[model samples]
Target: MSWSHLLGQRAALDYLRSAQKSGRAPHGYLFYGPAGVGKRTAAVALAQALLCHQPPEPGEACGACKSCRWIAARNGLLTNHPDLIPLLKNPETEKEKVLGDQEQIIPLDTVLDICARLSKSPMAGPKRVVVIPEAHRMCTGQAEAANAFLKTLEEPPPTSVVILTSSRPEALLETIVSRVQPVRFRRLSAEDIRAGLAQGNAKAQEDEIALAAALADGSLGRAKELLEGDLGRWRTAVMKALERAGPQACPGVGLALWALADAEGKRLFEEAEQKDDEPAADGEDEEGAEAEEEAAAKTESGWKRFVFRRLLDLCEVAFRDALVTAAGAGPDQLLQPDGAKLAQALAQRFGDEGCSRMLEALREAHFATRLYVRGDLVGRMLAGRMVSNLRRGP
Candidate 1:
């Protein structure tokens, strides 16, 4: 209901709470952290606390108030509130099937719209809360939009609060960042994650939960996505595919990797097109040419890259599990609790250094594919490197 609802990041919650209590709240606040660890949740909670009529804690929103109810009922902190300006991707319209916040990239038109909305007077509320989630997506062209918002931050509307949230804080302009108080949110613990799942009565295997938590690296949102099924399948599929492609005849490897790459590319494009909601027109025509170019500019490569990244991530988890074993840490300390024996075997075979080398090779292979290199060659090369390095005795 309050910032207390934000799992983990106790220090940040307390700091914001204390500032609210003291009435020393900054006009501009930045919440930066891994996605899905509740940065946006905390921001909204803080916004509600600021706007709440009868906040139990001086700065905390009472969650029971009309204002808080309205905020909570809204789809997103920025989207629903008249005062809250969300720079979220505009959904595809009947006329156009535009992307929705594609891979943390916010559209420029949305950025400008949010800026314009924030520049106006509050329609009904006492205070306006302007939020730009994925602020990093406010690209160079859109960064100009931040300038418009900056003046508001410098001299905010009476009782107005500006909240900026981003997973990639490094992409934000320094001037904009300097004007805000940064609150860092971290990943929730597996226990907290499990507790959250229990609240919803979600039926996910505990082992999968643990694995996703480890892969989340501190983002519960990411953990939730992994638990949703795609990431695990992607990881396992990539490993099996690579294993099959490697140590095969050159022609066979070519056929396998090409088929895999082309199939993945087509699937990604189709998913994107479906999301775009456009008719299946021939891509060679003038109208289709523009669509094709836009589609190409946006990577159909995301699917393959996602698979490769997940594979590399699995390898990293395996290494972390090996480290846990090597350090005499318990199975509970392992990222892959289900793979304890595999972790132990990996530890005996590769030790710490070799495990790192294997990960590096996998990453390099991903990079090579991105550069339009032959995927089969990269896969074979990476497989050879990992096998040579990891198959040796510690």
Candidate 2:
């Protein structure tokens, strides 16, 4: 729960500590960075320190204290602490929700509720801390939620601090941005991620962890997901499909990729269903069930996109490895070290130009996917292009 436990954010911690020591902690702070890079963790740690019954030093929270324990407690959607308010999107309306899915916008009602809470006196700690983990989702345009929240930011309570965290800070309102102090969180390096995974007791082997870190794009959250999820199995399947795909096998390869995507979508759907079946909290009603369905749909769509993107990344990495191998690169240069021999053989088959062309095709497919292109069509196009590219004369 201490800031020291947050790996790979030394600079951010230093700045926050200095601010605390100077007694100049801002009323509003924006912790902005990529997903899973410790923004929310840092915010929570800061809250604990601010509300700790006996803080040992500046920027340090006594985690064993009653106030800190309540803030850290997690029971369903709500935390045990009354003064520590977390404004997050609610997937189910029936529960006392604190956090939810990647919502499109923070509803106006939620913002008003937050304003009301801030108006009240502290229930336990010396100060109240409002943590908005995804503040960029605050409603814009005619909704007035962002505008409404501005009043609280403009004239914040004397004993309250608002902490806003977002991966997409550019999407936030200009006025809102101006009102808050910005704290930048950088992505963790591969070594940093590897160390963290080890510390977290990840079950993957060292090589597997290294591969995941390389593919994680500097996000610890992504690395952990890659380790715990089906990325390893899917990666193996992709390699096998590439090796088996001949000029006449484009349709078959495309079908295999389609199956993978379909299976992932179904898995996500089932998981959401299971979560829905969990009994609702005290105040939840029938309308909450309807919200759950909507949330499930959104989750499924997002999960599919993530799967497709990862598949595309695997394709890019494979082709890049092949290109490097064809140019007489060493094994250390390979992205997929676990499949080095396979990658080398594929490089011999495709040669330099073929690998380059395949990489370009994969890039185009990735762009198309981002533009909301149908996943099946993209898979088919990628399969056809890989076959055609590999079969062409040098």
Candidate 3:
């Protein structure tokens, strides 16, 4: 794969391509950006170029070459190449549940093992590439696992390069940040996202794509997510819930959001597990079931966290747009222009002051969710506030 294969991220692609042409690719690079802006894609593309047995073009990989083929074929996030090393955080352990770590630390043993592999000569290519797909969680707190891997980052083998990708660069350790070259990946523009969506197989309506683009907040990953997922339905649910909510129905809004997020989370977990494991027999031994249950709980927590957060994000965007609409803004000034009717209804029901207050309530709920508050509670709180702030006055 070549840089040309990845869409958007023109600036970042140019910088890395220049590094390859100049033969000055850094020993360590921190490619940080919002999720789905193409940091991981760049990492894979760059590695392919560096390891390609035959260059199809300058600073580009020959897709037909064995090196390029293996690199494109992924084992989870990492490539299949012998020279590629991935030090990933363990998802099976419920460290977040046990001690509130937010994530399990990258096991020190795994780091040491990868470092040991790096010490040897390159197994197949000119360089041994180290890719950390989640440095935000792994390299946080100056933890033992992070400290153990510091030596490799400080002075990698002459034939090796390290690439760390994270959406939360601020959370990484200063020492970790200082050692590597930094390349910032800005969010893709709306036009870029729209072009990408048009190329996809889903063949969604133009208006739907336009609405998704407006709501996407400049991340193509997020745009694709919103288009493919049930987030749109959740938004509609919120609208209908609030519009028809009486004393009895107000609480149901929160419960509905919670249940919807819970279901989405479960579906995501099941899909991932299916991708990771092949079909097995109907029944499992007690030990196997116990282990599977534990893994499910921990991994599902991460997935559910994202699902719930996305719901809140949609809520925040809708209410923010409603506030502007209430202030007499046109469709151009408001997001969800494709859903102007929904926004218009929201503006009429909430009015100016109510919209502002609901935004505050959503912000508070966002904070509580980050602190790992119960999802049901956050939903209930938001629902109650929306209902209480209701105004049908003349």
Candidate 4:
């Protein structure tokens, strides 16, 4: 595949392609971005172009070539190509694994492994490429590995290339960043995400795309995660729970606590982790490293946080709809889907002041959650207060 396949990050592709055509391709490069914006894909395309035996002009890989075939196959399976030595965390323990004394990531052991692979003559290809996903997972102690890799990056290996991908590049050593040319990827657009979902034949609605796009904040991967059946369900349930907890009785109650108590909720939490294909360093064996249970709990909490924020937005929209309806505004101006019924009911029961109070309760709950207050309890209390206030309108 060519670099054009990368959904966004046009400037990055142009720079890499220019380097290739000018025969000034750097030995080491970094592709950094939020997860799932096509950093890995771009790296693979570059690798394929570097190794393609019959490269059609400079910077373009003949996708039909043997080298391209291998790269494509590898991409399909998300495996490291022979020319590319991926710096990855130990899968078994799920933390950075140190191969040698140098605790730096892409430790000497891994770098040496790549060196050995590169030492061999090409098998019908001009160069060997090493692509490291989550390259920042390299341990600081593995500085020796980084140093070793740096030597190769600076000299020798006529046709060898190293590409590093990371969502958290700040975790990487400054030295490493300075040595390699950096390529940054931005989040995909909502339209791009919709096209991708369509291409994948995913079961997503227009509203679903809008919600996911809003929540994803640019990452197509995140948008896809939002489109997942579980997230959609969770979003719906959270919205209902918020509505149930209307202003006053206990306004905005601990809805997430109830939401997370189910088996499906736990399963959804686990699925969220699976979405990130990149693993952490072998920190599993390290002291004070995250425990599985603790990590799982954190993951679940993150899911709750995400769902809760959406609920807050839904509440505001519903309130806005109530206000608009109370003012005898057109349906098109309503924000909530049940705008007609809720608006009429709200106007009859609470009047405008009650609607204002309901908004205040939600705003307070949101602020409390952001301040690290107990989110579930705060949510429940907020819901109760909202419901009570709605019922006992001013």
Index of the highest-lDDT prediction: 2
Clashes per model (N, Cα, C within 3 A):
2, 1, 0, 58
**Over 4 Å off, model 2:** 75-78, 88-95, 275-304
Better of 1 and 4 by TM-score: 1
Encode model 1's per-residue lDDT on 22-97: one tens digit a residue. Answer: 7778888888876667776677777777777786767767777777787666523234455655554553342133
Q: Candidate 4, TM-score vs. the true structure?
A: 0.69
**How far is 260's C-alpha from truth in model 4 (Å)?**
4.9
On the 0 to 100 scale, the lDDT of residue 165 in model 3 is: 75
**Ranking 1 against 2 by TM-score, winner:** 2
Per-residue lDDT of 1-394 in model 4, one digit per residue for the tens?
Answer: 4576667677888898999999877878899877767776787788878878899878898889776787665443334444444443443353244332122345455666666665666656777777766677563566676666666666747666778877778977787888888888887786776665555435666666665665555766655545553545655565555445434423324555335433454566787578556674332111111111122234566555544554565566666677778788867666545446756666656667777887787788767766656665776776566566665524
Candidates' C-alpha lDDT = 0.61, 0.74, 0.69, 0.62
Compose the digit string of candidate 3's lDDT tens values, residues 326-357.
87888887666655666677778778888888
Model 1 CA lDDT for position 24: 78
Candidate 2 residue-wise lDDT, 57-171, digit = tens: 8667887788877655531133547788756444236335654534556787778878878877888777888878668778445448888899899999998889888878898
Best by TM-score: 2
- Model 3 RMSD in Å is 6.8
Clashes of 2: 1
All candidates: TM-score: 0.73, 0.86, 0.79, 0.69
Which scores better on lDDT, 1 or 2?
2
